[model samples]
Target: MFPIRDHNPSGRVPYVTYALLAVNIAVFVVSWFGLRSEYALAEFYYTWGLVPAWLMQGEGYSTLISHMFLHGGWMHLAGNMLFLWIFGDNLEDVLGHLRYFLFYLACGLAAAALQVAGDPGFDGPLIGASGAIAGVLGGYLVLFPRARVDVLLIFIIFFRVFSIPAWVVLGIWFAVQSFNGYSATADGVAYLAHVGGFIAGAVLVLPVLLRRGFWVQNKGKPPHPAAEYLFSPSRIPRVPKR
Candidate 1:
């Protein structure tokens, strides 16, 4: 099941979230158009994307941060943006824009580090916003466990949509990522980065959550009308203007 939307919304405009979305798209467009050939594009990614061996060799250390903005392809960019669109604003709402921005960066860095640790010698270049988006998913679960997320499921053209709690959705996601992480075949998905980013988000958000007394609301609550933030047309049915 894939999350299409969530009922919980941000309390204010998520400027940083919007900015990140714009920047990611912009970077991809520039990289896609500027390169003349496939080989050239690959070289670009290798230069900007995080290569664990290169990093461990005391070289190209900047890729840890840059790689998060560089996606491998259109679907990769779309999937990551969709997750960010669904979950990021709420975390930004909870953490405020600046802290949320830093939180995202930290998660990405931790993701790269963990992936490097998992296979320190892997030569392939890792690139995507997924690791950072995974962190947003983790933070969302901690901050809004009870919020209803509408998931779109498809199996052999049998399409279905349903609403479930954030915890359940994120739990399944984490389980799948963890399972794939230990699997025998490497599909080049960077499961370790996903796992690390998710954990980092939860750990980093804990203190802030406690300080803000959100721990008291640990049970989570249903979304209220006032909290509905519309960055775009929500997948959930919108109430008509009276």
Candidate 2:
């Protein structure tokens, strides 16, 4: 299951979220052409992607930050951007532009650090904005535990969209990452980095969340309210012919 959208509406416009989405897409387009040539792609990744082994050797430390902006392929970029688009605006609305940007970078750095720790001797290029986006998911869960997220579920030739609590969606995602991290094989993904970024995002937002009285205000309420759209819920057909 993957989230398609959320029911919660932001109290304010999220310009920063839009800007971030634009930047990520622009960067991906530029990098896509580079991937056409193997040497060019390698050179690009060498300079921008995070290499755990190089970092362990006490060099190219900046890649930890740069890698968050680079992605491996079209699907990778699309998935990350889709997530950022869905959950980022509300957080940006709550945290404001500057603070949200800082929070994102910090989470990315922490994620890379965790990945490095997971495999200090492994030599491979790590590229993607997933870690930073994972951070956004973490923050979203803490701030909007009761918010409703619409998840698109696929089963063979069948597809359906269902609404569920944010806590349930994000909680399941974290559990999967932890499980995969522990059971990873030789050529598997770095599930640990995703977990690390998620943890970092949640922890880093604690102070701000506390200061804003989020814990108290959100005690028994959902994050904001259901989104107001041109069409009403009645437009949806009832299941089982109602």
Candidate 3:
């Protein structure tokens, strides 16, 4: 299933989110088209992408930040950007632009650290904004647990769009990442990075949530009433007049 959009709307434009997206795209274009050859691309990734083994040796430390802007392929970039677009604006609205940007980078750095901790010897170049984008999802869950999101479910040839609470979708995603990280032996994907980024985002947002009186003022609040803005199930089926 893929999330298409959220029913909850932000009160302000998310400049930081848009800027991040632009940077990621620009970097990808430079790497793909501006670089002289495939070898140059590989070299660029090696220098910037998060490599656990290299980082453990006290080298390439900047990759913690740089890797967040690098992506391995088009689909990888598109997926990460989609998630960010869906969930980031609301967060930026709540946290303000600067704090949100810092929070994002902190989560990315923490994610890389966790990945390194999970596999200190791996040399594979880790590339993608998934870890950072996962961070945004984490914060969104905390701030808008009851917000409705439209998800497109794909089953074989069957497809459907449904509205569900943000908590349900994000919670399931986090659980899956943790389960996969623990169960997998080989390190093809950075499942640990996803888990780490999520944890970081959640933890980092706790102070902000508390200060905003989220728990006190909105305790046990149901999904924001605005969720109805997207779609609501029909109470009565259409009847034909003859």
Candidate 4:
């Protein structure tokens, strides 16, 4: 299942979120198109993406921040950007532009730290906004547990949309990340980074959640009115199997 959108809407314009999206996209575009050869791309990723071993050896210190904007592939970038687009605005809305940006950076840094802790000797580059985007998902779960999200479920040739609570969506995601982080032996994905980023985001947002009495005042939903979406049925006609 993939979340397409959320009912929780931010009151503000979310300039920071838009800016982040733009920067990430720009970086990906430059790396994807401007770098013509596989070697060049690999070199670029090595320089910008976080390599735990290099970091542990007191090198590539800037990668902790740069790696958040680097992605392994098009799908990787698309997925991370989509998650950020879905969950980022609301958190930015509550935290304000500057605080939310700082929170994102802190969560990214924490994620990198955990990834390094998990595999300090690994040399492969860790690239993607997934770790930081995971943080946004964490914050969204805390602030809007009951907010409805429209998810697209894909099963073989079947496809359908479902409106589920934020807790269910993010909760399942977190559980999967944690499980994979613990069980996987050689998967390239940085599941531990995701876990750490998520925890950091949730912990960082606790103060806001408490100060606003979000649980008491609004039952963990968005402070402002939630957005309502009207989903129209698909126009394509279904074809029977031959």
Best by lDDT: 4
Window of ten residues with lowest summed lDDT in model 2: 228-237
Q: Candidate 4: minimum summed lDDT over ten consecutive residues — where?
A: 226-235
Count of clashes, each model: 0, 0, 0, 0
- In order, candidate lDDTs are 0.87, 0.83, 0.85, 0.90
Model 3 compared with the native: what TM-score? Answer: 0.90
C-alpha lDDT (0 to 100) for residue 18 of candidate 2 = 87
Across 143-235, the per-residue lDDT of candidate 3 in tens digits comes to: 788777889899999887888888999999999899999997464779999999998898888998888787567552432446454344444
Clashing pairs in 4: none
User: What's the lDDT for residue 127 in model 1?
Assistant: 95
lDDT of 2 at 145: 82
lDDT of the structure predicted as candidate 3 = 0.85
State the displacement of the C-alpha of residue 198, model 1, in Å, after optimal TM-score superposition. Answer: 0.1
- What is the overall TM-score of model 4 with all chains considered together? 0.94
TM of each candidate vs. truth:
0.91, 0.91, 0.90, 0.94
Kindly list the per-residue Cα lDDT of model 4 for residues 1-242, writing each as its tens digit: 89999888889999999999999999999889999999999999899989999988999998889999998888888999999999999999999999999999999998989989989998989988888888888988988999888899999999988888899999999999999999964668899999999999999999998998877888877777877766734557999999
The reply for model 3, stretches above 4 Å from the true place, is 185-187, 219-242
Could you give candidate 2's per-residue lDDT for residues 1-242 as a string of tens digits? 89888888788788888888888888888888746897888889888888888888888878878888887778888888988988998888888889999999988888888888988887778988888888998988888888888888899998877777889999999999998888874554678889999999898888877898886887724556678544323446667954
Candidate 4: stretches off by over 4 Å: 232-242
Winning candidate number (TM-score):
4
